[model samples]
Target chain A: MIEVKDLHFAYGSNPHDTLRGLTFHIDDGEVFGFLGPSGAGKSTTQKILIGILNRYRGTVSVNGLNLQNLNSDFYESIGVAFETPNLYTKFTALENLEFFAQFYGSGTRDPMQLLTAVGLEEDAHTRVRNFSKGMKVRLNFCRSLLNNPKLIFLDEPTAGLDPVNLRKLEALILKEKSRGSTICITTHDMHVADTLCDRVAFIVDGEIRLIDSPRELKLQHGERFLDLEYRDGTSLICTSISMDKLGTNEIFQKILYKYHIETIHSREASLEDVFVKTTGRSLQ
Target chain B: MRLLAALKQDILFQFRHGFYYVYAVLTVLYIITLRLLPETLVYPTLTIILFTDICTLGFTFIGAIVLLERGQNLTESLFVTPLRLHEYLLAKILSFLLLSFASAFFVMLGASVGGHDRMWFVYGAIFSALIYTLFGLVFAARARHVNDYFVKSLGIGLAISLPILAYLRLFDTPLFYVFPTRATLILLDVLDHDYALSEKLFSVASLFIWFLVLSGWVYQRFDKYVRHPA
Candidate 1:
């Protein structure tokens, strides 16, 4: 649904380029997560895709239409939830949604339905100034979906959410995917990407270090070794073995034939581990 | 059509604040205060005083509204939407004008029954208030902070009104007549059924010119400041 080719962007007339010929694509109904720490150009890339920060030196097309030639109608086909909760505090949650809903000339969703989906139906009449950060984020999330956008740009949608609410929001993103919406999410939370994304891209310093399925990347970078643990009398005995030749090895045969094995497992790498190893930086 | 919906929502949202109540109370207080003033102190009709109050207060209201929107970052939010910048700006101006006119009209209605001409006061108040509001929007757009608008507008108001007020109280001069206050005074005279015909015509022309010039400035500045989403 979205394609970016050799995308490069720089702020103003500055000599330094923020994006250095980066390229990526997101297929239809795919949840693609751009994982990176802060100041790693995660937001700058999202801003370019959403058409906020202009003056780019690349080609970006959303839903088969070139971004350079698209107008406000392009906004009609997409939803955007900015990292910051930029809303009108003077208006009620419902009023904020309804006001923005009017900006689209066609296919506007019902504001009440959106509120209900985000679990804000009960507080629809209360002014947004009285809302908490999480509540405002939910409202902002609902606002993005008001146009029934085919593609959604979510920048740290789960940042201010608690675990329970985070799960609820994650489920909502999954629901949107089930309804055939392509999502481009940028977040530093590895768990979210691991659990929700169809594919994840690790970005560092405005460049894509790696992009692949979570399971595949983990398996590829993982150590091919096994650890066995068994209780021997009053003391616990641990042993390590190479998985490269485990079947024909006498030690592995002895452990299976002579010892009472309590647990045996291969050393598996996690998404966070692979992210750190590839980027040489932590997700913090 | 979509722009109109956004505008209607903005107007409704603005009216739901406590500040609207404060504006209503101030209008009532101004009417009662005018009634208490002795005859010698009251040069023009009470309706003219009420109209002038609207013109003064409208400037402050628009400045405050724009500053509030800027402070909350709602202006940038609107910019990202499909709503045109001109439509959003016009909606704000229209809402301010309508709200101020309603308050001024209620006061003038009561005052007109006593001695003032209703039509002249309504027209003059609406005209001058709109001109002052357009002037306020220019400053609001340029102001970096909300409090800065308060200080700058107060400075501008004083710089424009202080000399005119001093001259009117001290000595009459042809130069003083060129000021907005002097033109407003002529407007009041016309509203109170006492101005010469030529002065009344000149007041209308001068007030219209002020409205035109300030409105022109708003359009020019608005175009330069607003960057629509790509």
Candidate 2:
């Protein structure tokens, strides 16, 4: 749904560039996560993709149209949820959505339906200035979906939300996924990136370090070992064995023959562990 | 349709926040101040002060709104939408201009009720308010500090006008003819006194031309002054 090739951007008057020859593409109907630490050009990439920042040194096309050539109609097909809550604080949640809804050619979702989608229906009439950070985040999410966009860009979608609201957001994203919307999310949260993303890209210092499905990356970098726990008379004893030699090894056979096999487990690397190993930097 | 909705929302937001009410009171008080002037004074001088005050108030409020939006990063957020920089700026200017015109109309309506010749007041108010508001936008776009714009607008307005007001005593002073106070002076010279209608027509045309030129400058450089989502 979106493609970036050799993308380069520098803040004018600044000495250094923010994005350096970055290339990536998000396919239709998939949740593509751009995982990186702070200052890794995540927001800049999203900004460029959403057509907010122009004057870049590379080509970016969304839905097959060149970025520079698209007009106001281009915005109608895409929804964007910025990392920061950028609502008009003086307006009620309903008013804010209604105001923005007028800018799109597509029919807008009912304001109540949008509020309910973000779990803010009860607070629809309250002024945004009175909302907590989580509440504002939810409202921002609702605003993004008001146009029923075919593509959605969510920047740190779950930031500042309570666990329940965070789960609600994850479910909403999945719901959008089911409805065939391409989503691109930029976040440092590996757990979210791991669970929600079908394919994830590890970006560091304006470069794509790796891009693959989480399962594939984890398997490629993980150790091949089995963890075994046997019941000792009053307790359980645990030991590790290589997966390759488990059947032919005499020690494993003896443990199985002489004691109760209490439990067995296999080990695999997590996205966070792979990220640290690849970048030599913690996600923190 | 969308642009109008956005414009209406902005105007409603202004009203909801009590700026509309505050401006209404200031506008009323200004008209009353004009009426309370000594009757011996002519109509033209009274109208000049009233219109100038109306224009100043409009400029100040519009500048404040723009500066507040800049400080809060509201403009940056709006830019992310389909809104062009020019559309936003035009909406703000037009909304303020219309509101200022309405204020001026009501003030002049009071003057009309008192049997004053308000035709000049109506024409002069529009010419003065539009010019001053456009001037205010130019400063508000580049002015980093709101207090600074406030100080600068008053300082510039007074510095330029005080000399002409002083020269009004010397009816033949060349400086009086070259300055905006000249416009006010010519109006004052004919207040209770009668002047040819041709003279009023000439000054009115001059003021209208001044307004048009200033508005043209505003429209030309408005895109450059938008600050690019900073």
Candidate 3:
């Protein structure tokens, strides 16, 4: 649904580029996670794609239309949730959604349904200033879905949310994907990407270091050994054995046949490990 | 439709923030003070009150709104919507213009019984408000904080209003006519007596010219600032 090539952007007269020749693509109905630390150009790339920052030097195409050629009509197809919840503090949660919903021409979703989906239906009439940070974040998320946009851009959508709300939000995002909406999320949270993304890209210093599915990245970087845990004479013991010819190996067979086994698990790398290895930098 | 929605939102926001109530109270106080003044001083007092209400208050209100939006990061979200720069700007100008006109009308009624021309007063209020609002946008666009906005706005406000003092014979020079507020001051002068038709026409024409020039500059500056801000 979105394609970018050779995108370069710099603020004002600053000689340094914030984003330098970055290229990536997001397919329709696919959840793509852009993983990066702070000041690593993640938000800059999102802003450029959403048409908020217009002075970039590159070719960006959204839904088969070049970014430069698209006008206000382009906004009708995409929705953006900024990192900070940009809401009217004095207005009610429902009022904020209703106000923004008027900007779209047609195919707008019901604000009440969106609020309910984010578990904010009870606080729909509450002023945003009186809302908690989690409530405001949920309202912010609700605003992006008000138009049922074809493409949704979420910047750190799960930040500052409790586990229950996080799970609820993640479920809503997956629901949107099921409805065939392309999603682009920029966050430094590896667990979110591991759970939700079909593809994840690790970016640092305005450049993409790696791009692949989370499962594939883990498998490719994982060890080919299984760790066996068994109890020997009232003491717990752990041992590692290669997968190759493990069934015929005498020690493995003896452990299974003779010892009281406690637990056994394969040794595999995690997405966070692969991210750190590839970028030579921590997600935090 | 979009502009109307934006205007409604702006007006609602202002009301919710108590901006309208504060201005209403101030207007009532000005009217009461005008009632206590000597009969000979009513015209001058009304003229000064209207000028400050339309020109200075209009400018400061726009600046405050812009700064508040920036602080809340609302403009960044608004930028991504279908709302155009001109539409946003026009909504602001129209909403504030309504307040400035209402305030000026009350002050006029309190000072003059029913002898003055109301149309000229409305025209002058609108023109001056538009000019100052545009100037406010320019200043607020460059200001990073509310404190910065206030300091810069005060300096610019004084510079713009200094010529009005000159037009009031405080400085007494024809060079004061070069300022746009001088045109507004001349229009207000009609409250005293029937001014020459040629001078009235020239003043009205000059105000329009200033509006056009300032509007063009404001549009360009706003478009650039939103798309690629400093």
Candidate 4:
């Protein structure tokens, strides 16, 4: 659905390019993520694809149209929910959606229905200024789905939501995935990247350090050790045994046979561990 | 249809923010101030009031709206949709033009019966509003906040309103003729007096050139400072 190659962008005042050379592709219906710390040019890359930042040195094509030549019609199939809620505070929630929905032709989701989907149907008539941050975030998310967009760009989509709403939002995103909508999310949140993205790109300093599926990366980076807890007389003994050649190792066999095992489990690296290890920087 | 919807929403937004109420009180103040003037002075005073109302004040008004929209980050969100920049600008222009027209009409009703060409006054109000709104749009497109808009607009406002010094005969210069504000005053003057065809054409032609120039400047600046601020 999207292709970017050798993307380089620099602010006018700054001679150094903020985005040095970014190359990536997002398949149709696939959830892709740009995992990076703040000021890592994640939003800048998204803006270029959305055609907001046009002064960039590279090829960025979205839905077969080059970002350089996209007309207003090109936005018909694309939706973006900015990190900050960009909404009219004076307008009611329903009014805000209806106002935006007018920009699209047909096939827009009903404003009230979208409100209900985000658990905000009751506050549809309330001014956005009265809404909580989570409510505004949900409303912003709902706006992204207004056109049943083929490609959706969500920046920090779950920033302000509580666990319940966060899960609900995750479910809604998965629903979008199920319906074959390609999603691009830029966030430092490892959990969001792991659960939502089909393929994740570790981007830092306007470059991609790595790109792969979360499960694959975890296995590649994990220690693959078998953690065992057993009772040795009155004391409990804990040990990590390598999974390599486990069946042939006499020590692994003896631990299971000689000692009363309290627990035995494999230790796997999480995406967070992999991210930190690969990037050599904290997500913070 | 989208333009109309945007126009309606702009007006609705301003109204909800009490702009209409502010206009109500401001329009009344204008009518009352005009009514107190002597009959001989009413037209000249109305011309001055309408000039300020439609031109200078419209400049400030447009600045306020754009600054508010920017503050709310609506400008960025707006461009993400299928709305063209020209359509968005047109909606803003039309909304403020209509407000200026309505306010002028009420002020005329409360102050004068007939001594002027009604349609000319309407045209004057709209044209002046368009010219000055575009003038303000240039500044607004670059302003970062409400105070930023107000401060920057003050200097540009004074610079553009310089033609008034020549109109009032305090400082007469042929250079003032180069300004669209000179053409704006001509349009307003046309409402109260019969002008030669050549004068009317010059007024119209000057405003046309200024409109095109200011509109282009505004579009470029808005595209730069607002759309691609990143």
Highest-scoring model, lDDT: 4
Output the better candidate (1/4) by TM-score.
Answer: 4
lDDT (0-100) at residue B23 of candidate 2?
69
* Candidates, DockQ: 0.37, 0.38, 0.68, 0.78
Worst 10 residues of 3 chain A by lDDT: A68-77
| Candidate 3: stretches off by over 4 Å | A245-261, B227-230
lDDT (Cα, 0-100) at A30 in candidate 4: 98
lDDT, candidate 2, B1-230, per-residue tens: 66786688778767776777886886788678767877564365455555456555766787787776666556555665666655676677677777777776676566543335456645655566666677787777766678977876777666545534443453355555445544544453343446578867766776777667766676554544452321
Judged by TM-score, which candidate is best?
3
Q: Considering the true interface contacts (CA pairs under 8 Å between chains A and B), give the fraction that model 1 also has.
A: 0.43
lDDT for each residue of candidate 1 in A174-282, tens digit (9 for 90 to 100)? 9999999999999999888988899998998888988999888888988888999977666678988999878999988987887788999888799999999999999
> Which candidate wins on DockQ?
4
Stretches of candidate 2 off by over 4 Å are: A228-231, A245-265, B41-54, B70-72, B111-124, B139-230
Q: Candidate 2, which CAPRI tier?
A: acceptable
Ranking by DockQ: 4, 3, 2, 1
> Scored by CA lDDT, what does every candidate get?
0.77, 0.76, 0.85, 0.88
- Number of clashes in every candidate structure? 0, 1, 0, 0
* Candidate 1 vs 3: which has more lDDT: 3
Which runs in model 4 stand beyond 4 Å of their true positions?
Answer: A230-234, A245-264, B191-194
Candidate 4 chain A worst ten-residue window by lDDT:
A62-71
Which has the higher DockQ value, candidate number 2 or candidate number 4?
4
DockQ of 2: 0.38
Model 2 chain B worst lDDT window (10 residues) = B221-230
